[model samples]
Target: MSTLPAYVVFGEALTDFIRQSDGRWAAQPGGACWNVACVGVRLGVAAGYAGSVSNDLFGDALYMLAAEAGLDMRFTQRFDAPPLLAMVPSTQPPEYFFIGEGSADLRFDPDRLPVGWRSAAQILHFGCISLAREPLASKLVEVALAAHLAGKRIAFDPNWRNLMTHAAYRDTFHVMAGITDYLKVSDEDLQHLFPGINQREAIAHLRALAPFAQIMVTRGAAGMSLFCDGIEYTQPAFPVTVADTVGCGDAAMGGWMASLLRQPDAAPATHLRFAAATAALVATRTGAYAPCWEEVSSLLAQQITESPHAQ
Candidate 1:
């Protein structure tokens, strides 16, 4: 089998506090880039995660989960502080509460980046809370700019959270956008970050900001749209009985990256179809669980049967 392209996902990895029926809580390994890395590895992609973790139990669990998911762990750091935690409210629209103060994830230092790590990666994916903090955010910016100068493909998912209202976060958003090659943002994210801006206006604004970048906007349930190479193509999301919406977007990102890395010259429509299908399937399950390739293949087949022109 041909070796898949290497992917480096840099950001925070934390425990997600999920609500249970008994009014209790269950902790699961999560974080946007972490989910993407897991799903990418499960999809047969060579993936690595770069970030810091506390030397606590939660951090150890994350390390174990990353190994089990087949993610390369050479660059992960463990510190003496506590691990970051995110409390996710169980509702139709999820709400996030971050609880990380002087935690390990925020202590990531770019100087400690693994030796020869960037040499193996074809793409570097980063965003979310990673871009909202200090030291780490500045370090990520340095790496991203260096990668861009090296002509490597860069994938960015703003994954904007409410905390972005902070000046540092907003500033990083614009700074990162300039160096991104592929940009993904949710409809809600766009509105939250740039309120009073319509989709068309947002697209135009982003295009002007990063003229060479391909922009993708995902609308939950409705589907996603791609604006690239001076054209727009949209793919409707697959129909599925959603058990939980967690990890669905990350699944989409992973699937999209997998397809693009495998078929660099494929049409944007084909990319969107694969991503949307994978995301829909993920929504049918709970937590950060990812469907196997066979499951995605079955869904793709069904999608084609339902809409012959999907690709």
Candidate 2:
């Protein structure tokens, strides 16, 4: 607990206002990077979110939740700027707009991070709209690039959004994807990232972009596919009643990374199954729910008990 966390996730921490089917809006503590970090921590990983948030109640909630989840609070910063917000007016792809003209996420200063964070962490994660904004985006890119150059593991997930269609964001995406050691993208993201291209071509492009990286593509309820070591591995999604798909991808990424770090030499198939189960648990709950390690293991064990050969 005295040392830095092994997992460091950098990006925005915002409140999501998802409109419900009943014509009402629900507020949830969400943001791709923030949720991923919290998921790792809750999944029994030494993780922390390396970002800044407003010092108001919204950020206060995020801060308190992360702290209670056992994230080392030394890496997160607080600013007096307005809190960032995501207004999701629709579902299926989670269409939303940002309200961060001067949000605290924009004020994240890498210079203020703990002195030894760069060398201490095992993996540094970045993605989502965090790479869409300026100043902070460029700074995050620099941080990621530096981490890669130093031989530290770097994980990236484009986490597509409407704002990512910008020409500028395209350049940023390629830069991050190219340097990342681990790249995680969803089926929806592939369509947005490589418009007019087929899945095979898009994946080929990603392989060319990050030749040495282990790439993972999530296929919603269908399951997930992985391309690693010049081979392909697939894992089926665990059957679970649907609640909402929000944060499912983050759960997968967090679960994958947690298993990778915790299990060390576990097979890629086992890791994928672990991740799929972690995400499945989250889909049974609303918001960016962080499933604990016990719940995930229980689900996996129950699956084995129910159908020994299915897994």
Candidate 3:
């Protein structure tokens, strides 16, 4: 039998049709949770993905991409439903349009999960549209709660989208937040949850819900902040030439989990620093590809040389 994965991600796997300003388009296979699994694999973590993929060309490509990234697909489901599509504007976040009412990625069946999968993984990651809609949404919660009860760490990155009704988002938010062991939230995600609030207030709100969870809030260019057990740590973003912002947060979350899993005794500050460096490297490139460990180290070395106090 094959070795079990250390990390398992449950979410959607879909395509993004990014429209360029010059009338060209690029189709990419990316979903927030899918990115976490792929990036974790690329960062040398044993990761598995539990999501639905259509049997279409795009779905085939995404499946191959996951395989290439060294992710275990034993729990991946395939269906006849068409792949989900998103219209990504060059200047704005991607706007999703479900290709078919019953898309493959949204058809995840919790009852059909691989036997012993709960004990096979050390951590279960959740986020994105998988937590927003129907049967799948409820199923995801059921699985997450099971994992938590089984003593597996739960990592979440809400990756909130307006496509989900405010009520749905609120409910999902509280349920996951209550049980999350490691959480990655963005300023944007918080703003959507609590309108017109500043970062401190947002953190306070999240802390009240998940008091013991190690929460990391990504603050774009200003960098990220960490809160755990009444203590807070902040780290500035690594200085890097910008390429595009695509997959930046996913990379950071992936790196953070990878670092923590490997060095369980490391401080939260150490984890955030490594994660920030990984995110900076991804920002210096295009697409959702993960950076090699050396790449992140080299960037960190340079940052340390340039700014003695950095990281």
Native-vs-model 3 lDDT? 0.84
Tens-digit lDDT track of model 3 for 51-70:
98999998999999888888
Cα error, residue 96 of model 1, in Å, equals 2.4
Evaluate model 2: give its lDDT. Answer: 0.89
Best by TM-score: 2
| Candidate with better lDDT, 2 vs 3 | 2
TM-score of predicted structure 1: 0.93
Q: Count the backbone clashes (under 3 Å) in each candidate.
A: 0, 0, 0
Ranked candidates (TM-score, high to low): 2, 3, 1
Candidate 2: which stretches are off by over 4 Å? 304-311
TM-score list, all predictions: 0.93, 0.95, 0.94
TM-score result, candidate 3 = 0.94
User: Considering only N, C-alpha and C atoms within 3 Å, which residue pairs clash in candidate 2?
Assistant: none
What's the candidate order when arranged by decreasing lDDT?
Answer: 2, 3, 1
Best candidate per lDDT, number?
A: 2
Candidate 1 regions with alpha-carbon error over 4 angstroms: 1-5, 305-311
Model 3 ranges off by over 4 Å? 93-100, 305-311
Residue-level lDDT tens digits of model 1 in 104-163 = 998887777666667778999988888887777888988898988988889999898876
